[model samples]
Target chain A: MIQKEYEKNEKTVTVSVVNFNPVWGDKAANLQKIKTMVISASQEGSNIIAFPELALSGYECGDEARRDHKPCSMHEEAAETIPGSSTAEVAKLTKELGVYVLFGIPERDEKNPKVRYISVAVIGPEGILGSYRKIHLAPPPTFTEEACFKPGNDLPVFETKYGRIGVQICADFWVYPELSRILCLKGARLIINCAACMVGQTGPEFIAQITGCRGTENFIYAASASLAGKERTLSYYGRSTIAGRAFPSFKQIFAQGGDREEIVSATLSLEKGQPPFDQLSLEKERIRSFELCANELKKLAESR
Target chain B: MIQKEYEKNEKTVTVSVVNFNPVWGDKAANLQKIKTMVISASQEGSNIIAFPELALSGYECGDEARRDHKPCSMHEEAAETIPGSSTAEVAKLTKELGVYVLFGIPERDEKNPKVRYISVAVIGPEGILGSYRKIHLAPPPTFTEEACFKPGNDLPVFETKYGRIGVQICADFWVYPELSRILCLKGARLIINCAACMVGQTGPEFIAQITGCRGTENFIYAASASLAGKERTLSYYGRSTIAGRAFPSFKQIFAQGGDREEIVSATLSLEKGQPPFDQLSLEKERIRSFELCANELKKLAESR
Candidate 1:
């Protein structure tokens, strides 16, 4: 295990979203590309930098039935263990830059090296803290996640000096908002989503719209990084975004173009504070009020 | 009861959202204004037209403690019983136009005329269909609804010739995605939202964003009508919108301007269809997959 070192000076953390398309099934090249981004993001003063889903081996792997598909040839061959090779290199970079990095990778199950799981890993200067598996698997034929990988079962919130961070893979972030709500209930102040969804197929406007609500409704900071350009037969939607509470009232705070590979960054406040509109607060008291409202409705329903 | 008549012609329903500014606490004037808008919506072939929260009496009502306040002077005077003078007139018009209308009105509780509930009533050629009381109440100072109106108890889905419909008031639509989910589970094919949220306070972008998600996630059509212009200290954000599942995809189909009075209309297909991305489907099979994923996470949590 390597020692991890983080900047002890700041409470305000600048988070960066790296939106870039990777060469399908190429691990060495993807890692090399991300290393350069980490250096650039660090130079730009980002305390935490995040990348799109499956950034290590790309995201064009076909479903279980199509495992032998062209792009996925690299999935099994390139699958790496946590401390294997990618994180070791990422860990060194984080230590040197004093920045934390979270990126997606296709993990090879330890007991059975042939088995792979869609996963995201967090690495600091010291070493790899841990990883979160993609809980929600996209069904075929839009996303073949379930076809090739075993779905992840945990919704882990990583604790840091700045705030508690919760992560969700691409499709997991959509449909089931319960994932985000539960994360917030568990004390996560910031939610990060890593995705490699197709571009023109699912418009960036739609992604931005949903991403914004997740942040505002939960009264937490949300940052998403998506793959840009093409990933095999699919074209990725780039517009990576970072949004905050709508109570204090703000617009599209940080967003990237749908057609481009770019890094979007913003400084987020993680301190527990009251919203300008008390009605939008995510505090326990506010949650209690909502419960009371629910109870009142229950009584009314019974009476009716 | 007067005889009612409606055009029994088509399965395709054209929904209209009436976005307008209401005179504070003036029910008669507001009714007159809506009458004109309903005629226009009918002319555009809309079978169903929706109006903003308290469209008949305005939404600037202060809490019970602040009833003596000037804006709320009409609460006692303006409160009317359902199927009262207003609905009687509205029903006549619905029959004449051959259309269904959903609008907000402050209802004088039948058992106790002194008490009122923030309610939305549905009227067709057959007269009053039913009503939904706002299940969730916004707390002060964003809104003092809880201080005045009792929270509603039922999530009723009204069955019509075209499709099943669900109603949610302003604040009820936000915070709880479960409200929409339950309506969908109960077979609502269309969800209507009536809102009078403040302009600069709750950004139009936020409202529009959340409204779109409610429709897409539920695989149902969603329409929102919000009050425009200034009422007392609050200026309503009036971007009435109509959204549906992008069929084979997801996005907001039609939306109106934020600071204007207008009717936004869209003809939607209510037939069960697959999402643009098959993985995005909300059908029972897909729902079951989500349950399985959730169960897996639960097991993982227990192990940890």
Candidate 2:
């Protein structure tokens, strides 16, 4: 794993985004790859490290015809519980390294064996914090997330020693701006997106643009870790990025990985003057719009 | 005026975005400039033409100190009614040329002369169409819109011969994604943003990025026209753009303008196969999320 760092100062938090390809349906190999990266990142002094969406089980789960013909699909077989074996192993590593880790996995419902969710598991030193299921599933015609997985209902923000962090899956971050806004209102200083962004879906540049806007609009740090390389018919382009307010004013890409396998890191100062956490003034200013937006939203809902 | 056009077919609508510096608070000169551009654009076969926000009186309304000291500030003095002399003249031009025009001006409230709005007036061949008032006012610390103008409460979609069009001012377009989504839900085929986007507020590239996202997310044509050159302490970068889905799939920038004074035009195919008007399938797909988004928004509002 290659390591790079931004200039660090007092009251700073360093984040690392891992961009790698997972062997399709190979949980053991993927878990080992993730552990190695976690250890390396922890040794490099990263407070938080994030892996791409569906990194544990890979993205594709066989063709539609085959899945329909078979009694149990590859995704169903690979799906595990939130605090299942994979997360338990990662939690132990996080506990030993004293660093937080976030990665996506197929989550099997505890009550119903048939139900599954495309979720990102947040593992901290204390153990598994929680998982944020994919809220906005990729729609039909081109993408097929909605066919296999059920959409998530809640938007949860996890508390960490470094700061409050909110997680979003690929479509949740790319398609819906409301999710990020709600997360920001709930006091999330950082928004992390775990994505299995494919080349055919949208341009890599457009993804970075949306990621940067999420940060600029909320005045918070936004990071996206995406899967790379080809698997089955899909080709994932891993242009992972961490975007937020740079020193004085303008929002920019703090650190970015390439379209190939790589790890990008950036050290951000959370002090008052150093932005993405200018909470007091900016939030007060934005509060005026919240009521207006909420009222409009309510009206739209009532009409619908 | 430099004119450039994308290849047009049988069912296509051409749009022109004007990037020009208004003579600060000079109604006569600004109106004359607008008329000249409209006539030029109409001759170039543009079905619709849009100008920057506060194009009549310019963006800055003196300074905070001057505004506090004077009984009638420059903005108040310059404010006019929706169907006032400016729109009347523009309507005459549009009627003569057979085209639709959208441009910003200081709108004086019918009942209270002291109350003003940063609004975009829509004028067509028939006469004066209604104006859309700036909903989300730019807050303090930097912007002075809230201090001088009353926020508009409604989101109106105007029906035109070409399509249904929605208008948004600078802060409304940049800050709130909800407004655009609501407009899209209300059956707006195109969203036009009139902005006096200053350099210090955000990068020009960032503005284009957000503009593209607005189009890509909603699956509709999104266009932005902004003021060019300097006005007192503020330096406005034009960079107006028209973004939407290209031929088969990808969302891309169809047309764009530069930092200096210029006029950009694009001929967009609005046919069934051609996108930004793929209305049937895309709209049906997005309806599922609308109810969910609306419900979440209501919850947020109630909590607030």
Best by DockQ: 2
- For model 1, the stretches where C-alpha displacement exceeds 4 angstroms are A1-10, A62-64, A67-73, A111-115, A271-274, A279-304, B1-11, B62-73, B275-281, B285-304
Tens digits of per-residue lDDT, candidate 1, A1-304, equal: 0011223334578999888889887788889999999999899899899998998887877453465322255687877788778899999999999888999998888888767888888888767888889876766655566666787767778877665688988767766665676676656677889887675456667667777777766667788888888777778778888886744573345555456778888886644443553444444433443344344444434654
Of the true interface contacts, each candidate retains a share of 0.28, 0.23
Q: After aligning candidate 2 to the native by TM-score, how far in Å is the CA of A220 from where it should be?
A: 1.4
Worst 10 residues of 2 chain A by lDDT: A1-10
Clashes of each: 8, 0
Candidate 2 regions with alpha-carbon error over 4 angstroms: A1-10, A65-72, A273-304, B1-10, B64-72, B247-249, B274-304
TM-score of each candidate? 0.86, 0.90
Instruction: Give the candidate number with the greatest lDDT.
Output: 2
In angstroms, how far off is A257's CA in candidate 2? 2.1
